[model samples]
Target chain A: MAPVGFRSVEVALQAGGPRRTKASCHTLMEPGMFIYTETPEIQKLRKNIVELVLTDHPLDCLTCEVNGNCELQDTAARVGIRKVRYPDGENHLDREKDLSHPYPHFRPVEMHPVLPLCAGLR
Target chain B: MGTPLRVVVDEMGGGFREPVKALHIGGPLGGLVPMSKIDDLSIDFESFASNGFLLGHASILSVPERFPLVKYLEHLFAFTAHESCGKCFPCRIGSVRGKELLQKAQSENYQIDRELWNDLLETLEKGSLCALGGGIPLPVKNAMQYFSEELKPYFSRG
Candidate 1:
């Protein structure tokens, strides 16, 4: 999949013959074009981006329900984010969980034992 | 575009009688030009860029000398946080974090960690999907650059 914040293009042509323009990860490479995938600048930017997201996120990975099965955890590991540099500030972690939905189907499967009977009835 | 900024403020806008500390040229996300540098700048994109500022929208909001620049910076952050579309994380969360930092500094005299501050700005600049997030750092950076003395108390000791 194309990286987030990057445009996905199947085919791009330089119809105007290459005037000055900004390039991103999806920009089509031309002959003799050189691309730097993991430069110091790129690494720093990637790390910083992940750190920013983690700054506001709760750091309760060890005790969280999805400890072993989380995409953010996987991405953080891949990016090598050993620590989040941002200081503790306003965050949504402490907000009361919204359990207001009336649908029991939205709850965990174990909590709704009659779900199987309903499915079989259907 | 070559017209002097002073002309824009004084001649066209009918100059203020009271002392003005800085001019927030352009809209809310625009860079702040301290009173000291107002005369030297011209109403152009390159001029603002060279001076570590931005001429976005070219609208001016004059800040009086009595007003605290930190408060102005806080307002900018608050505006961004409220206006963000919530599609992307960097802008959605970063703006709120920025606002919180400023609020703490204002209310509790908190000393912000400079490294963390820089990291937050960098993330917003590089990771955001659009200008709303990317361009915010320009004005904040301008204030930090031009009005460092005013903002000194808010930053932690190195």
Candidate 2:
């Protein structure tokens, strides 16, 4: 189960007391913990992130190799980036794609300690 | 400082020349000025601050007439992104985004919103953890201010 309550740092430490092994205790285990507060600045930062990613991206959403399984697409959606800030002509689409690698690709979630999510690059 | 100091300009072709339009000082992120403003400007701290330029430890980048100022700014951001330490949130992400925006603007022919661009620049300038992130926008803004007419062809109303 996920932690749903909070105590003072002092209280929490005391509660864990002598019985606590490193594995026995943790902090801010909730998925929403450390959530980014959406200020105007944060919103701009997010928009800029989308703009940057799309610069090299072909934006071939319908025909991409990853198609519905792309992390870049998901990030764009989550950030509410409805439109790219820059023009599409500037993307360096001349670079060749390398598809010969045999290894399976997955984006490892670096979110936190407990639950990790993986999006495969197939 | 302005009387004795000499400005250097470099064309992308790896040759250095005197400023045809503006002289870039203080590395890639430093302020730029038109050649007409050269004698009026000084190289001292106070003068640099007042004129929106940097002393840049005698480092000067001479951009010729045809050199794309916007693309140069974009590359500066790219370099900053590559060198960022990743310890701070703003610098790590902001540089990457700034690089992208510049690329897109160049690619799209500058059809982007002016307000949005300014806001993002403001955030990077204020929030970056180091000079790498914060200072990269200086030259960009300076270019826009002094070279707006030259850059207009790269933009559209929509």
Candidate 3:
């Protein structure tokens, strides 16, 4: 049975605004090769990368502490990024902390819980 | 448009164990919330930094806070990092300094949180670049503003 007054999330979202959304940090890396331009090349690469990382690939780690509790998967699905340039075993990253402070020193950078991805990596 | 956007939890590069666990240490605001904790929240610039945190596909997952000080400042950090005008000094130098101060506050110097942070924050607040740098102090400052007594342990105890 439906809730007392529940038509659909889409309806609720529409009431508010755009319910269709996603968590996309697109760099808009348009071949900075020039001064301005999203060059078809860069866009393609971006789309490819997006697809690869998102597919069946794990959004949160296998046993991540934030598992179902994670926002990454939700955002990714919203963005519809099911493909990338490569696969899970492809791109290398800033897996370790680049720098540290005297008190709360950190090693692995990509580790989200330690800090936000913005402070750690691209 | 409505409320804050969907939360963004990053299990960076297999960093966490699958079927992740949740832990909220920020007292009530941060205990350990699961996905079920969040429904569909509509977030726009209010929750976005526009610069630092929202670079490409990277996003921040927010835990609801009874007191918005820490959470909001947490949002500002990345924004300052991203929107930094690099125009004058404070925004540029101050934002960097703000990061340092945050590091200090979160440090082990439990004996000198006040004296240390007060000075550190004063500098960043006064000399930062855009509001980005200048604003970073709000979270910690506001925390101290309202919770200064709670934070006195770092100073008076010393």
- Report the number of the highest-lDDT candidate: 1
Q: What is the interface RMSD of each candidate, in Å?
A: 9.0, 11.0, 19.3
Ordered list by DockQ, greatest first: 1, 2, 3
Model 1 lDDT per residue over A11-76, tens place: 223545543222244254676544554556566666666666677677888987878776667767
* Order of candidate numbers by lDDT, starting with the best: 1, 2, 3
Q: Which stretches of candidate 1 lie over 4 Å from their true place?
A: A1-34, A94-122
lDDT of 2 at A69: 91
Candidate number that wins on DockQ, 1 or 2: 1
Fnat of each candidate? 0.49, 0.05, 0.00
RMSD of each: 8.0, 11.3, 22.2
Worst 10 residues of 2 chain B by lDDT: B4-13
Give the C-alpha miss distance for residue A53 in model 3, angstroms.
Answer: 40
Best by the TM-score measure: 1
Candidate 3 CAPRI grade: incorrect
Ranked candidates (TM-score, high to low): 1, 2, 3
lDDT of each: 0.72, 0.56, 0.36
